[model samples]
Target: MRQKLILERTNEIRCELNKVWDITKQYWYPLFECTREDLISFDSNYIMKSKK
Candidate 1:
């Protein structure tokens, strides 16, 4: 995630990482308290893409 965002944002990776981190914490962090089923939410592929 950090790598992808850094690639996209270039020199702004630090700032972009912070923004994404905050947003992720705000919305998804609480899910950590949930059961594995709930936390799974779909799959890791949601955050990944096919590499060339």
Candidate 2:
């Protein structure tokens, strides 16, 4: 009975992780296309703006 409960909980966690993965893949694929220099520049600008 305890093992069955653990298995169910594991399956729930797997389903949540899959959902997160799908969302990240949809949203983050474009970021992956960015050049390293572009990412660095963006990050620096973001940091500078956030400090204000």
Model 1 — TM-score against the truth? Answer: 0.23
| Per-residue accuracy of model 1 over 1-52 as CA lDDT, tens digit each | 3445446477587568545544344344445443333345555575566442
Candidate 2 lDDT, tens digit per residue, 1-52? 3444588898898779655544244344345443223324246677899999
Q: Once superposed on the true structure, which residue ranges of model 1 sit more than 4 Å away at CA? A: 1-11, 23-52
Model 2 residue runs over 4 Å out of place are: 1-5, 23-52
- Report how far residue 1 has shifted in candidate 1, in Å: 19
